[model samples]
Target: MLSVRSKAVASALVVFAATPVSFASAGGFGDLGLGNTDWQVGGFVFVAPKYEGAKEYEVRGAPFIAPTGLDNGTSRVQFRGPDDLRFRVLEFSGFEAGPLVGWRFDRDDNDAARLRGLGDVDGGVVAGGYVAYRGGPVTPFVSYHHQVSGDDTGGLIRFGAEARAPLASGIFVLATLGASYADDEYMDAYFSVTPGQSAASVAGLAVYDAEAGIKDVYFGLTTDVPLSDVWTLKLSGRYSRLVGDASDSPIVEDENQFFGGLGLSYRFNID
Candidate 1:
């Protein structure tokens, strides 16, 4: 087992190795990286009062609770902001990279069951960096985000591709597909079954803890409706599947999530 010091050292090495790629592209906010050298930063706040089923999953066999499918409907209301610094690395190829920091305000039941140890995640800060390449239609990116200290105290390694296209009526669409691999500490803390619990007797199934290495595959599509050069309405829908030990856990019961959000994004330094 790697000691804490060893783990920290390994993580640091990974971060340094990947930081350069994020700046390999110079496009705009829509690209994988933050865009060209002209660094720009912004934040967004979103609310989903009507999307009750956004991230909810099914629950069964609760003594008196009537087994009402999904419980604790977490009305999606979250405020997240990212401080991004983009630097132009290659002018000929339009490449850029930078570091970004973000924070979120709510933790849903699944996130609680998976992110928080026992209850809701009040809020937490995530600090990391991204490296990306964008020279044509296909842009590939790799990013590392570690929650400094919060609901999710684990590190995530993600590699993905983004494709952008233009449609009629001045509408633009961006499609993304990505996968991630997470370590045990992050998994067990959120998806593990407790010792006292008897998953076999209760449901005739074996419950795996969060420590099991899990793989997640996700795909998303975002569209931009420009209301002028400075302002655009951005909306996106994303879907994810959790597999491996995390997927087999009793708490999750082989669950999946569909996420959708709408936000207004403003772009500065459009030259």
Candidate 2:
């Protein structure tokens, strides 16, 4: 069995893989008018339990960078953490859509001692497209990604909605609810235990064949505070629940996971 700390680390990695960091758009309310182009660079630290059922916790640090309104305010781009990146191809009348790309981190024995003999899951590239409609205070979005290079083949679909509101002076709250659907290839790569894997299992885990289905549902909240004209601080928390075959996998220790992080960044604007 995996230790609590190991499980926390794995869970944290999953959170990192699934979520993308984002900053508020320019000319929203403060009206700093920094320029037509806006960008931010910073770093954040987060804590999460390894996987699902592990009792231990893991702490990790990641850099954040997001640049928007690059093409004379017609294009937007963002480097959302280490695992996810996105670019908006066009924006018009509250509708923005574009290409999305990301990398899946590898899972190996180093992640958990209990994973020994299970063989490594090599990281791969994910390519997809997303469409989002920002009408009023609510935004709904959906995306489809295919594994172009990695141990996992097939693809997954992600759909979600987000909303934001002001809490107080210089403070704003953002919330998101989302879920993902995984194909057989993607589910098997992460959750399935093959006969060979069961035979070599050090933890005596039973063979599990994960099927394609709804993988997990997640909810997250983020709060942003502007420390000054050029600096901002962000705090965030999230919860996820595994469902369907993913939760039934013998390798899954817990079905519920939690994550939290804090970040500070310096903003720049170009005219």
Best candidate, TM-score-wise?
Answer: 2
| lDDT against the true structure, each candidate | 0.45, 0.66
Query: In candidate 1, what are the lDDT values of residues 176-243, reduced to their tens digit?
Result: 79877777655655555455343323343344556635367878775656677655555656677877
Estimate TM-scores for all models: 0.56, 0.76
lDDT of 2 at 270: 61
Tell me the spans in candidate 1 whose CA falls farther than 4 Å from its real position.
1-96, 104-123, 196-207, 212-214, 227-232, 263-271
Candidate 2 segments whose C-alpha is farther than 4 A from its true place: 1-41, 49-55, 64-75, 78-84, 91-94, 267-271
> What are the clash counts of all predictions, listed in order?
22, 12
TM-score of 2: 0.76
